[model samples]
Target: MLGHQLLWPVVAIVVMLVIDVIAVPSFLDLRVQDGHLYGNPVDIVRNSAPVMLVALGMTLVIATRGIDLSVGAVAAIAAAVACTRIVESADEGAASAAILACTTALAACVLLGVWNGFLVSVVGIQPIIATLVLMVAGRGLAMLVTDGQITTPSNDAFSGLATGFVLGLPIAFLIALGMVVLTAVLTRRTALGMLIEAVGINPDASRLAGVRARTITWTVYVFAAVCAGMAGLIIAANTNSVNANSLGLWIELDAILAVVIGGTALTGGRFSLAGTVVGALLISTLVRTIPSIGIPSEANYLFKAFVVILVCLLQSPRARAALRVRGRRAASSKAVAA
Candidate 1:
């Protein structure tokens, strides 16, 4: 059953890759340059890293029947904090400055997460509303950090995070992969995953069964914020600057789409990290391929929307049943004709 559920998303990714290959023959052309792997495949993975990380956290939050709409804003704020700190440091290129900048930025994000968790868990605000508060305010906070200007910082240690390579692969990709593995291990190897699922599946029932629903909920929100923070850092590092307004603009929607495309229910319950990863890759591929295929920039979003809708329809149970019925009817007709 699980395999069946997961199959369509995998197929969708393959289909998109095929489309990419057809549109741009060199899409799959990979080469080793300067001891590092370089290609479209590499770019897809590297570019999708931020969304992948955000979606990973979104999967957890969604599993708990919650949404963190503020992730993108959190990303902006994180970038703002990190870059502003780096620029302010006298020794901007020093490793110590980079470390401090990252730490401080991530710490701020964690606190923001705590605030989000508090609003939902203690203040009894709806998850959407609670997160919306941050979603709307976070960018403003980021702007304040950057003093309402784009922050350009020159720091090799920071830039190395996004541009550097590790073991012949992009460091960004490696970091994202590492986070995915860590999240999977931390959740699956312990009772945490089960507890979270239980809470997500039925908070009232889980509480009755000795689950700390509040703690689980709060923890997931914090984790989501942390993920957003990390993603923000990656975005800033990639550009070697921070544009608070655009750093993670509308990324929450992308993360949510990734989670949904991966087969995670928006209504909450069970979630899949593997599926989310595939979904993020699918999105990244589309983003990269659209421009190559000569789609007008103005209508690019329309094409994406259409594809998303088609994929969702294909994943629908009713649609699948109808497709099977049609196949059966066609087979019977063929037999009759024979």
Candidate 2:
């Protein structure tokens, strides 16, 4: 559905689904209960929503030849700010408090993005180094926000973001889908997509050609933080608590992996939202499949690494060429034997 470029990711997911179906025959059974859908597929999508949102923003950042290592940290800060605000509110359970908490959290994320953007786009720091500063310190900042303790606020309105369903679908997934669509429309329907690619492909050249390269880069960093912020809110809502230390640890790595698996080169240039969608789903499916198929929990990372490495090799042009050369040599040997 996302063209030939997405074939491998799609195939990987399909294979996993097939395996899941065999391992758990009822994997695909969908039952509606209380106006909500329940099943492995639904669960996978729901579970992957936060990652998808982060990856969506990561895609744009990568497309602009930049990285946001601070995304996970930024998410933690956002959750900390939000949950702390709600807990300190006069009415923690009030809808207004939840709304205010969300707004404040996103605003804090925006400011953090501005700081990152300033360092990279304005101060001329390497994206990785610039974001790394925050990555290392953001947890401490979050701890400060919550006094080094977990904040568990009682807010049904906020919790609904993660636990509630709308029209038989997960609200988190729907939010992700909406953001994906909105991002697609804004980038594709306008000249912004080309400008971003141009900057990624060659910043100096694009700047000479009248593209606002720094502006584009800064904007993408900010957007990435906002996406991370939304993801943080969802994660905090899920447990109805915010543990700054663990809110979004290592999620940045997953977002980067999703972007790479989606066929977006780390070196930048082109991007595909649809590919990312498949990639995120693939990652989620792998998580689900591992336990269901009896893989040891201790080896989960290793197993996932193996699969990811295999897929990456399959996707590499040089690797494909080497395989082709081997195939040709084997063919010649067979002919000579004949």
What TM-score, computed on C-alpha atoms, does each candidate reach? 0.97, 0.96
Question: CA lDDT, every prediction?
Answer: 0.91, 0.92
- The TM-score between candidate 2 and the true structure equals 0.96
For 12-58, candidate 2 gives per-residue lDDT tens digits of 88899899899989988999999899998899999999999999999
Please list all clashing residue pairs in model 1, or write none if there are none.
none
Candidate 1 displacement at residue 185 in angstroms: 0.8
Q: Show where candidate 2 strays beyond 4 Å.
A: 1-3, 325-338
RMSD (CA, Å), candidate 2 to true, equals: 1.9
- Candidate 1 residue runs with Cα over 4 Å from true position: 1-3
Residues 260-337, candidate 1, lDDT per residue (tens digit)? 988899888888898899889989988887887789999989999988888877888888999989999999999999
- How well does model 2 score by local distance difference test? 0.92
